[model samples]
Target: MIQTIAFYLFAGLMILSGVLTIMARNPVHSVLWLILAFFNAAGLMVLVGAEFLAMLLVVVYVGAVAVLFLFVVMMLDIDFASMRAGFMKNFPLGIAIALVLLAELVLGIGAYRAGALALGTPDGSAAPIVGVSNIQSLGALLYGPYIFLFEMAGVILLVAMVGAIVLTHREQKSVRGHQNIQKQVRRNPDEAVVMKQPTIGKGIEL
Candidate 1:
């Protein structure tokens, strides 16, 4: 009974949040709602005994992706009126795309209701390890047979991050108040310090 209640609560909240995410006028609010939806979906995953998936949803989607979206929305100078006008202009195309998606969804549902498509028989090659938690099992799989692949993925991501930084980096010309170490090192005490005793009524010359 508790599980059922929790499931319904999470599901309802997730649905409501998803709706609010789309209906929100403010992009930041939409991102917030999307984050909320992700949280509720994570809750549902937890209830379904997929705690690893739940953690991923919260940590990866909610923590990183949603936060990035929120920050981008908040930081960007979005002209909503012009955006709305563009949306209106592209309304027909949007509707057509939406209808195509709807048709695909309907077809998928119909296929599922009729019978699951025979993808392939499970050969037990990727079966979960017994007597271990799901996360431990996942870790074993990741760090065992797929360790090299996982390491390669990490390397790829690192390269991409470096590339992005390099691409976005700008070299500023004639930056104010910037210290030139070469100039400083090359300086002579004679030129650097002009020790002059000034008269009582006269200002010192530079």
Candidate 2:
């Protein structure tokens, strides 16, 4: 079937791109590979009937996050030789983190296999509405039951962005041509501008 072939194609490409993303020496190339992986993952999501997720993968991950990452990698002056020199120093820490991640994955799999969690049976309430598009159903579910949580997340992100700006912002008294909106707003027009009335034949002195 075409679906099967497409699924395999997407999956294979996604896996290959993921490997390339990690293996590429150039950070910019790695980001490009990452974007490719995101595209293939989006394709897989479409094949799995989760079109909403596919759109999010392409729009958010590929469009925004990956582009931002590529720009950051390209802008930075990375010393690859120096980084490679420090690899052995950081190898033990990396190995420890990897082991921790592996242990977490094993625990998650064991718990899933044990099936001890008593999640309540799905009453048709959470199910997608008949004859509705995937995006519509997902939007309804998110807005209907999770509106407050969604708003809270937005607020948190807004606060975090503002906080980052505040933390990084430095007022420069030594720098010329700095903008002071409040100072400009409160200035008297008479002090800033003078009415010059001179005699017809006399030159006005500044």
Candidate 3:
């Protein structure tokens, strides 16, 4: 009974927050509504057996709060009126792309019904794999046969991060006081260092 009430409470708030997120005139309010929706969704995930997913949702959303604030600030810079001006001009292209997607979906569904392609989901009569939680089973699967692939993915991510750092630190326009190693190395000692001849009681003018 408690679970039922909590589920309903979370689900109802999630739905209402989603609607408000779309309808709110203030972008900051919309983002706050969106965060509320995320929290309720996380709660619903917790009510289900997927505690890992719930924790993941909470951690990711909470950790990237800086990004949410950045988005709210950036909302002020958007030209909504100018974007709306292009709506009619872009409507036909959008409709055409959507129709193409719809057609693809219809064809895919028909082909699936005809069994022309095999989707590898388990059939309904398969016995439940008891004795283990979902996360444990997932970890075993990830680390058992695919550990090498997982390590390679980690390496790839490391390389990508290194590349990004190198790119950003390479050179920048209109930037103040970035170290130019070559320029510093090429400087004459006389120009680089000014010899100070000051009286004992006075300080040097910097």
Candidate 4:
């Protein structure tokens, strides 16, 4: 009874927050609402006995992704009124597209319910699968079955990261980087220092 009540409460809160996340005028407020939705989704996951998923949703989604969204929304100089005007202009087209998407989703669900689509086995069935544990299964699939694909993905990501660095990299004539490192490593006191006797009031010029 307690679990059921908690589930309903969390589900309601999640839905409410999700609606608010889309409906809020302010981007920052939308991010806050999204965070609230994540929190409630985590609660729902916990209620369903998926503690690992709940923790991932809370720690990763809420803690990291939502925070990053909040920071981006806060830092960005977006003209919300202008965006709203643009959205208003495109509202009818967007609604028509959304309705089409909704219809497609409903058709897909109906097909799925009627067993027309061949999805994988149901949640818990007595099948002799290799690894049932989340981390273990993910690791086995990543390193064993899809190792080549994984390596290719890593290479692609590496290329993208290097491309980003190359795009943002700039050379300045005033900023000496490599020369300073070389000079520091091979620095000699005799070359850098001078010993001279000077009068108390007069400074000696090097």
lDDT of 2 at 13: 98
* Candidate 4 lDDT, 1-206, residue by residue in tens: 99999999999999999999888999899999999999999999888867778889999998999999999889989999998999899999999999999999999999999989998765543322464755555566678767999999999999998999999899866554445766588888766757679899887746
* Cα lDDT tens digits for candidate 3, 106-160: 9999999999989888764333246987777667767776789999999999999
TM-score list, all predictions: 0.80, 0.75, 0.58, 0.67
Query: Which has the higher lDDT value, candidate number 3 or candidate number 4?
Result: 4
- Which is the leading candidate under TM-score? 1
Say which prediction, candidate 2 or candidate 3, comes out ahead on lDDT. 2
Per-residue accuracy of model 2 over 103-199 as CA lDDT, tens digit each: 9999888887899555578788889989999999988988999999989999999999999999999986645877888999999876775557888
Candidate 4 clash pair list: none
- Tens digits of per-residue lDDT, candidate 1, 1-206, equal 99999999999999999999888888888999999999999999898889999999999999999999988989999999898788789999989999999999999988878897555788887688898889998998899989999999999999999999999999989779999999999998777756589999896766
Model 2 score (lDDT) = 0.90
Question: Ten residues in a row with the worst lDDT in model 1?
Answer: 117-126
| Backbone clashes, each candidate | 0, 0, 0, 0
Off by over 4 Å in 1: 112-116, 175-206
Output the TM-score of candidate 3: 0.58
